[model samples]
Target chain A: MKFSILVSEGPYTHQASDSAYQFAKAVLAKGHEIFRIFFYHDGVNNATRLTTPPQDDRNIVSRWSKLAEEHKLDMVVCVAAAQRRGIVDEGEAKRNGKDATNLAPGFRISGLGQLVEAGIQSDRLVTFGD
Target chain B: MTIKKFMFVNRKAPYGTVYALESLEVVLIAAAFEQDVSLAFLDDGVYQLKKGHSTKGIEMKAFEKTYGALEDYDVTKLYVDEESLAARGLTADDLCIPVETMSRAALGKMIEEQDVVLSF
Candidate 1:
């Protein structure tokens, strides 16, 4: 089945991001197609490359980035939410006069329209949040 | 594209977190997709519809007015849980907009019929 996931919370603060990551992994393991993974609200924090966890800890950001890279996953962070939380990409950094970009690899900043498009195109849309 | 029944199940209060407003943003965008969209208000989500919301003292942007623009987006299926309303001492008349009051059981069945169930 084609599935789309919506994550609405950031890592560490809530289990929504972890649960979404696990669920996405399980779906891929089960040989299901993930149409998209949309990050909204605080969930956009998962796309920042600036996160540096302890060497012993599970780096949630890297986990998602690697999964997205391996699977060629369409990981999208809402532009509005990302801007509000300072998750700017290269283009946005230049446009908004920011010093540098922090968007992690394998994730693109997009509009909420991507989310609605996911709902229309995918067979199922699952949301995880507080 | 398939016409999916997308239901956003809101169970949280507004302002404490960004869920309510962010959920509304999705709904507004979903309108353009022309999917069958519905908004279910249960638990503390019922408070989102209460009339006369004041965010002045809270120092937050009062988005209660945004709810009124939902109709313009062609996304108007708003369902409020009857039990939740009664528990919170609110009635349909107290809400910012008109809604269909359904029993929790009925709403459960409705949820079962949805292709996508988004909880916030």
Candidate 2:
């Protein structure tokens, strides 16, 4: 079965992101296809390439990026949500005369329409929120 | 014409934050577009579905009552997660508006059936 997961919480402050990540991995391990992972609200922070935790600490953004890259998964962070939370990418930052957007590669900045499209296409839609 | 069904997922608490009310407004506004809209209250969102919520203390109108008026807007689909209601010790009878209750698995399947799903 193909499933779309919606992560609507940030990593450090909320369990929603971690739990969703774990669940997504488990879903893949179970041999199911992941239609997509749609990040919105605070979950947009997961796409920040600038996010750095202690070297020993778990870097969830990197974890998500690696997972997407390794599995060739489609991970999308909501563009409006990302911008609202000060997470513009290189083009956006350049256009706005800021430093850079710096969102990770495997994770693209899109919009809620992607979520809607995922909803329409996927066999299942799961959400994790805090 | 495909009356694209939309499930309005409300996941925030009702007090102080704009998400709860803003989510409601979104559902109402979408109903104007004649979309098939449903509401699902999960997590702290179940608080928004409780009965006798008078926003008068905050000098805001009691939009809680407006849940019933969803039928007026052709947004009759209403659902609440049973685990959320159970965690809060609430039953469907305790709410002012009528709603179909389901398990998380069922909710997952239902959300996939919609043409659109918006969360706030």
Candidate 3:
């Protein structure tokens, strides 16, 4: 079965993103395909490379980026949400006249259409939110 | 393209948080795909459709009117939970738009039949 995941909360502050990452790992280990992983609302914070945590704590953003690299996952952060939260890519940074792009590796900024497309394409759509 | 049954489950208040508004944004975009879309309002989400919202004091956009425009996008399947409405001291007459009020069990059944369920 193919499943798509929606993470709607930021890391550390909420467990939604962590739970979503674990679920994604479980799905892949069970030999199921992950159609996409969409980050929306505060969940877009997971795509920022600027996230810093205690040395002993789990680095949430890196975990997602690493997983996406290993699985070639289509990790998408909603552009509107990302813009509102200041998670910018190079193009967005240039277009918006920002100084830097903090979009983490393996995640791309996109429109809500990608999320709707995930719902349409995947056999199941699971949302992890507040 | 194959059409799928997409349901957006709204369970939050409109003003206190941004979930209700963002969820509606997705519904509007999904409408363009020509999919079978339905919206479920339960819990505090029922407040999203309440008539006569004044957000000027909160300085937030009064998006309550957007619900009426949803019909123009061919996305009019709005379901409000009867128990939730009653619990909140509200009724169908208090809402800004026309919706089918049903029991939670009935709404759950409808949700079970959907290909995708996106909760907000």
Q: How close is every model to the real structure, measured as TM-score?
A: 0.96, 0.67, 0.98
Interface RMSD after interface superposition, model 2: 4.3
lDDT of 2 by residue, B1-120 (tens): 335777888877777665676467557766765667788888888888899887777986667777878888878778889999999899989988888999988988988887667777
Clashing pairs in 2: A88-A101, A89-A101, A90-A101
Chain A TM-scores, candidates in order? 0.98, 0.94, 0.99
Give residue B61's lDDT in candidate 3 (0 to 100).
94
Worst 10 residues of 2 chain B by lDDT: B17-26
Q: For model 3, what is the alpha-carbon lDDT of residue A83?
A: 90
Docking class of 3: high
Best by DockQ: 3
Clashing pairs in 1: none
Every model's DockQ? 0.79, 0.17, 0.89
CAPRI docking class of candidate 1: medium
Compared with the true structure, what per-residue lDDT tens digits does model 1 show for residues B1-120? 667888989899987988899889888877778889999999999999999889999999999898888899887899999999999999999999989999999999999999778888
Query: What residue runs in model 3 are displaced by over 4 Å at the alpha carbon?
Result: none
Error of 2 at B5 (Å): 5.0
For candidate 2, what is the DockQ-based docking class? incorrect
lDDT of each: 0.92, 0.81, 0.95
Residue-wise C-alpha lDDT for candidate 1, range A28-94, written one tens digit per residue: 9999999999999999999999999899988999999999999999999999999999999999999
